[model samples]
Target: MIAVWKEWAGEKLNESEWLSLLDLAQRESAEEDALVRGDLPVPPPPVSGHPRVTPPPPAPRHKVPDTPPPRPSTELDDRFGPWLARQLRRSGLTQSDLAMELGLTRAAVSAWVTGRAEPRSEVRRQVAKVLGGVQQFAPLERWKTGAAVLIGVSEYTHLPSVPSIKNNLSALTEVALTGLGIPHSNVHTVENPTSAAQVHEKIDLAMEAADPVSGGLFIYYAGHGWTDPRNGRLLLGLVESNQHKTWTAMEFDRLREQIADSPVGSRLLVLDSCYSGAALDTLSAGLSSASRIEGTYVMTSSNATNASRAPQGDHFTTFSGEIIRSLTDGIQGGPRVIDTDTLFRHVRASCEEQGWPVPSRQIGRDGDRVELMSNRWGQP
Candidate 1:
């Protein structure tokens, strides 16, 4: 079998070709052994240039029983129905009263509850206004204790085509974090690690060393991110003897869980790589507390629809460079005071001004908005 595989490895065999060879070899070997034992007759080899025989006709297809029609696809009546329902219950608002207040029909409210229809955009806006008006809906708050850990892994031991642009991104992140008053002690960089295990171990160490007394924990990663087609899990590339073997994004989520389970306030994760947006949803599922108070805040360099790219003239990517600039703005006192929204706006503006592709940002909290803390003056 080993010899056969080696011989066939040099040839370009399709699936059928390989299967045919295997079948023929197996049958020949079995018949040879049978004849040796005088237990069966052995067939002679076919003559050269013999005509090929045609295969017998296939059996006729039988009609399949009709399957029952699938149930009608159901959609939530309120576009924000699911989210609104949760918010209403949290705020102690009854469906009827809430519907009346929002000028929505009672039946529409019922459909929302039953998820038979979705709220229109206008309705969602009104609902948001109500929630905001009463302070029933709030953004997530920054952690009061614990430091964030940002890790950037770049460079590859094998695949040279895999760019080393992450080095620039790491530099920008480091500078930004530093400008933001995130201590150097709280930041880590992993470059061209020999194996995925080493990268995972390093992340574990960083998470372990985090200071829970600081308020919030932040983790950032910039590298080659890949997804496993079979499992739909995200993966981070590392320097490996075999390029195929790399650390999975699931491992990072595990690391996040370790930090979140601790007494630390909250965890924030920032990933700058291809397909990072998917990681947000995947990681959110694994967190024990999906709320803003318990789980981590996730920000990706790009939306699931886009790919992140390295900057052309600079070592950093456009997003990383803009974030750094925001942190360094008015840096006489360290990172400028900026809110999360403001920071993102600055990033967006910079990208636009430079004609660089802008990456989308999404924020998911348990039930509140997330507040980013920085000495840099401005909103996030």
Candidate 2:
């Protein structure tokens, strides 16, 4: 049998390759035969004095030194600082005056304005509030008025099991989140999570840590979302074992519960997966305004029947790319404000121009209209 197998295997390779293949096959056959009879083989322990096979010493069990965590990588100081500086100058206040109002040292204010240092979250909010009141400083409108939470997930365990349409979806979300001023501290990217329970914990922690009084919360997911084979229930893929696993879309209902119980002004959920529209339906129904303050807006990459495609280059996923563009160009502060309807229109047009399918959504119970102030939208 061995001779016959080798002769056949040799037909596809050269002499040296055939020899190499034969050796590998023999080793595999020996291992297989050993396992079939339930034979257990034990190897000798490592020799302590052999230079080539020295025994390793037991590892020390000690507590690792607690180090201060690295600063979050929002990098907002570089891009937003000059713009803020200009706004401050136009406010007719010197750094000293601004510092006095913000209760900071002159040097600290100068550092923030000159990009020498980044301001803390509270300082950023104070600056926005001050500029928000000035009509001349209206260009910084969104920065001044609204606060937001951005969430993104990227790494997956089973690459093949990942959704075919959203390969670059996480990257797209990252770019959009960073560009739109969502602090890195708020961005959560899970890598190769192993269980549904882990997914729940990470998401719960992020949502719980979010600010309740800002503009809204944004959640972005990019991975394989599955429907339970048994019940046809939607599931968000999570890491489990050596393969892909899933969490029910219904799990997000807990987020709505938190929002319902909190004083958050508004909420927005962005999903990039199949049947994402359906997920929104489930989520919206779970959330009620009975105890909440504002409405929830749900945007999906595609309709329930469609799939969202990966982004084109360094750009965001089609829907998210357009949304970020709209935010950057249409909401950059000006007299003309871009309302939610207009923002969606822009997103639709941009997607249409790119020949990608348009995103669909169901806006639920929003009492106050969401708008972005943009000079490009024209006087409104």
Candidate 3:
């Protein structure tokens, strides 16, 4: 009967409503079982209703049917306020102490502590930072159900070809499949896209092909990144991209909008291109101005004014090379899964040590817990 309802309800309702309907049915079924088992009291029926419905007949003690429970989907935001309050007390710090540290008013901190106003994702990250602790990673199952778009621009018509791009694409693909455990079918790749239109099409196809229930959407771009001299808007270059002609390249904001609009619960973006770091303001741009419903993590090669390094004779570009290293060599003593921010920290430290362009990073909402790959050596 539930299956029949699901079939009819699914056709009539949206995904969210259908899921809610199923959840309601599941709850009702559980309550009915509890009533039959005498675990709950049957509510008194009213005579004014359309008709009086008979309650379920009692069954044998051992014959109660087993039904799966609904998955826990409650937002963790409700707990954050209390958790922050507790952490502050445990650390023996007053609200003023935190306010000073975060450069906010005491009242603002109090709001967060009292659950009057919730901190945004970035602010939550800062809160975690002020009260320092090791980052906890998400479960490995998240990435196993995730999707990725590996884009490489190796050969350009108006620009010089960076032969290293092909390696970047192939290597990241391997990481996504093996270390990340993402299905090969869900991993999309576009190489040497000829025009900006093609890049847009590829993005559309990726969004269309990605499963609606996908755990996360991971997009990586390794190519020439240009900034519009007129407006300073970062552009992801294509084969036909002209450094001077702004219309020739795909604007970073376009990709940002697309990802923000995606239904995927988590998002991770990796860019190994010059001036890529300028696009880090994606989540803060428009939607929430911008909204991060699930998770958002971005790793960029260099700052807005800096150019990324492509070391000669290296297997991959400098920024992407460190990423490949993290994947192939799982961090020892890390958590069960390698979260995106963890990977970024590892890559940033490595790049800094080598005197290479340090990668820029941003983590918002639950992005810190968004896992990407398995830890070859770590505890659960």
Candidate 4:
């Protein structure tokens, strides 16, 4: 709608235009609601004298101007600090007004004007487009590195051991997570968890320690996966699991519940094992579907039926190793900050080429891209 309006008007809508449009919409909505509720209008009191004497003609109202006040000094300026302040003063716009136009916070706009902080390239481009200025934007000095919770169980008491999983966890922590700029202490690892309690406990602690308002969350699991025949739910077998005592394993649905309750705005889940697709299913379910406020990403090594092969001599499982390689090696060719969607496509293509089970991905429509790692070292 905004695009159509911009195209029709031959320019972006200014603050006053946006506010007037909103006010008109709200007034129409209120009238519709009153009509639906069958509220009758009250007539004005009848005139007492001279059977309603004629009144003088009222002055006609004029339409409000569509264009915003023009800015002075229209020459291009690459320095955002001076450019931003000049535009604000010339157009008679406050920092708050510019913030509304840019869909950003007033503090963020203030920081850009005051030289306290710089906007990322994407935001800088948006500012240029909306306010009409120099289009060039420099890369951020530092990116925001997020937190991660990695869980890998290679040894199961009742199931055949998946030895390569341990290596997968190590590579994910040292190579992938660290390469993405996640701090060593912030990357929590749970290896060969003996019971479900330990896995959830570690996850809860990581989520608690993370500051979700600023960064993202990544959860990776590689282990022996199973599907309960009766309920068709997925389970990740733990160290003490057995056929009769199934309480030892971690259920995918339970993990989904936990993730849904997380306060974080961005979450990425990567699983490698048989029946890992069940986790994807749970992610698509009603309770776990991505909301407008938060992004949800799920990537499984294979479908529920296919097995994730771990070649005997390889240090890591075929699927897990490919993922690690994709992150570290592929980072050079891709954007400085690698998002999960792009990384998934690269990994999936490799798997298909190698005759391995193709990975599956579920990305939310409303959710923004979730960054997995930054090619360059970054702060936070």
Candidate 5:
């Protein structure tokens, strides 16, 4: 019946809605069974408003059904917020103390402690790290299903292509898949996508293989970028992208919508191209002024107005190379899990030291953390 309704409605329900529909239906069925078994009172019939003829019933109020609770993914954010709050108190750290340590505002720290707000994915990872150091906390569990799409375009038809992009792709694939131990079959690679259609197709294929329920998704792209002259929008350079032909470029806005619509619980997008931050601007435009999408993490190699770096004689682009290095070496401390926040901080500092364009980062929501690589076996 639900499938039939979806067919007639011309839209399938999201996972949350589908699960709620099933739960509500099950409860209704149980109630009907109880009525048939003579263990419950029958609901009263509606009274007619008309004097002689029965009046048509009022439309049903489609109140949103109660959703099931989400499974706990972390200690501080999920099941034991209050307990973690207590732990923070016992650790002799004031709300300000914790805030200063995490480089967050005291209000933000208070929100997490008082259950008013959850820590963003990277923040949550740091929370676990900080708390774990002061106290014996449980280690974070790795996602059961992990998938990645590594795309590179070194050969372009119109634009000055980013050279050695294939090297970037190869190194990234190894870092994310082989070095990180993401299943070989779960990783998708697209080399030199020649047109917009090819790029979209590969992204769609990767998303299709991803499982939002149990795991995460990782998307990495290394290429050139151009701002659409007509509207100041950013465009990703495909193999056939032409600076004069707007249609030939992949609009970063459309790419963002694709990632935003993904069902994955955790998503990591790493864009090693110029002006990729414009995509975040597109997503954040409006009265809200802030972009907040749950479970998505983005790291762009350069801001919307800056040029990304490609150091001479390097096999990979500067920003991309630094990111890969941080992931492989593990950030100074033994943070077994390398979150984007940690890696981006490292990258930004490195860029500043070397006079390269600093990278930009955005986190959509809390609890969407994706572990880039495990540092347990030590660096390779």
Candidate 6:
């Protein structure tokens, strides 16, 4: 949008300090009102070569904001990745579903979504129709304003290695989450953190990177997890984490406190390890009225008592793999842009059907609206 505006305004637009035309117009009106009310002095009009600005044509009000103006179909074709990804997300259609419908391979759909390949003209039209036409997908503001800190400990110092944890980290940060339009630069990772301080360091950086008002922070931990036997407090294993020495592990409540104190109001935590669901009790208190944080949410791989799975030989852990599958494949009957609530439902259902430990979550204020990814179910 800024690029489009820059192309239109050219010399008139200040690249350093960019403000929306609507904001400028509103600010002008407010200044005029203040002048009329004797609250601010009215400046004399420029007497030289300065030109008075003309207001932009009125924008027709619509149910959605940030809806782009109509452009040539060729232009849409040029941005096939964004267009295809958006429709898939909004329609909740899966790559496999679309592939089956078009009698093409799922690889073809994935290529289209990722912009590695484009569909033929006729096929593009078919896809547009299948996903409720070629309407613009405008729910990306959340992704644009969001930042993530993914910490995965695949090879712990003392605990048994959950080798698939590496796959969980890579697939999520590099492939699945990026499909939602989050810039790769905005996603931070702590692959094999040595100590609790390193985990805190990554999260602190992510918090600093995100916008306090509109931006969100997503912190994911996928490795060995432990709970104190006496009180069930969740702890994430670091490289030197020991099962017997619980204090050697990264205390979740400590991380929770940092997140609660951070300026970013919208926050999410995705845990894919054993006893992760235990954070529910802690998050419930950490996100109470006393803290007054909004859009704080969680999704754990298992319940407070059960163990999460890694199957020994799979490329990805069972839980995180399911999440990647859900995002990539899309829920056929779900909403276009699936929120965490919707994601939890799909994951929980899959786990229940397979008799695996079910995922867990407790939605915070406006947490449902804090969408994490686009539903890929593009076809009915």
Instruction: Give the CA lDDT, 0 to 100, for residue 315 in model 3.
Output: 79
Candidate 4 per-residue lDDT, tens place, 105-182, comes to 999999888867767646755664554321111111111345678999888778888788999998888853335556
Better of 2 and 4 by lDDT: 4
As for TM-score, the candidate ahead, 1 or 6, is: 6
lDDT agreement with native, every candidate? 0.51, 0.49, 0.70, 0.65, 0.65, 0.71
Query: Please, what are the lDDT tens digits per residue for candidate 3 over residues 181-233?
Result: 67778788888887666656666666665555646778889999978887777
Q: TM-scores for all candidates?
A: 0.49, 0.50, 0.60, 0.59, 0.59, 0.65
lDDT of 2 at 320: 63
How accurate locally is residue 12 in candidate 3, as Cα lDDT from 0 to 100? Answer: 35
Q: What are the clash counts of all predictions, listed in order? A: 47, 5, 1, 0, 0, 8
* Candidate 2 displacement at residue 33 in angstroms: 92
Q: 261-282 in candidate 5: lDDT tens per residue?
A: 6667677788888887776677
Best by lDDT: 6
TM-score of 1: 0.49
Give per-residue CA lDDT, model 2, range 1-380, as digits (tens). 13323234213333333333323333334444558779833434445764333222212213211332222213212434555565566554678877887788999887776677876555555664444334322333332333333333344444344332233445544443433334456555555455555545655655555555544444555554554555444456544322233342334444445545544455555666555555655555555443244565667777656666654354445566667657555543423555555666667667778887777765656623554344343222
Please name the candidate that would achieve the greatest TM-score relative to the true structure. Answer: 6
- Which model is ahead, 3 or 4, in terms of TM-score? 3
lDDT score, candidate 2 = 0.49
